[model samples]
Target: MAKKLELGDPAPQFDLREDGGGTLSLASFAGKKLVLYFYPKDDTSGCTMEAIDFNRLLPQFTRAKTAIVGVSPDSCASHEKFKAKHELGLTLLSDETKKMLEAYGVWIEKSMYGRKYMGVERSTFLIGPDGRIARAWRKVKVPGHAEEALAAAKSL
Candidate 1:
């Protein structure tokens, strides 16, 4: 596993297929802060709630000059359905190969019910306009996460 990224580290760059079409890249977010969140799957309870929370607070994030993008191993088609079902406003990117996930150090070994497996650890990164990580939250709790992220973005 790659070392966990720390504050001030350059955020990993990514170019991925986004839901509803088109590509999203780290360069596209230049001159603006980014909230890059990783979730294990689409449409799962925690993932859905996290997306909803980010969607709900999207306007605030926009006002803060921050853009939010959610990443998951789900396909672009799956992302589309999930976004539509939840009426999500933020971008959802597919990382089917998990390259970006590994680059960001969020794809990790996880244990549930005494069983170990590889999965995306629910994580969030705040990347400043200068492209350095401002903050990171690993093993994120869904509730109130968006708000906390927004607060950090606003401080940037």
Candidate 2:
């Protein structure tokens, strides 16, 4: 069982390697609003749409003082290829061990086409500058989702 984080709860600290190189930690993003999103897999339809949308809105997010990060149980190599193929400018963290996914409660049992499996549930968390969860979206639908999150971040 995973401990689900809630509004006002402190975001879990993570220190993971990024796709291009070097490490990323939640503590390192203390002063900036963080958009931490978890998806089932890379290169999939929904995930790709979500990433592309975010990538397209990267400028707005940056102007709003938010840093976006996508996480999946994929390796650095895979993330690198995905970013290159899509021209993504945001950070993609490799959660190959699922530690951060579990901590954020995005890793869950999912069912599709009458088949069951455990994987990351498409979710996004907006961490305020104070390191607390200001907003959360679970089982997020990709269309217009990134825009919605950006609007919310601007308000914060």
Write candidate 2's Cα lDDT for 50-109 as tens digits: 999999999999999999999999999999999898888889999998989999998899
TM-score, cand. 2 vs. native? 0.97
lDDT of 2 at 86: 86
Model 2 ranges with Cα > 4 A deviation: none
Could you tell me which residue pairs clash in candidate 2?
none
Residue 123 CA displacement from its true place in model 1, Å: 0.4
The superposed Cα distance between candidate 1 and the true structure at residue 89, in angstroms, equals: 1.2
Query: Relative to the unseen true structure, what is the C-alpha lDDT of residue 155 in candidate 1, on a scale of 0 to 100?
Result: 96
User: TM-scores of the models, in the given order?
Assistant: 0.98, 0.97
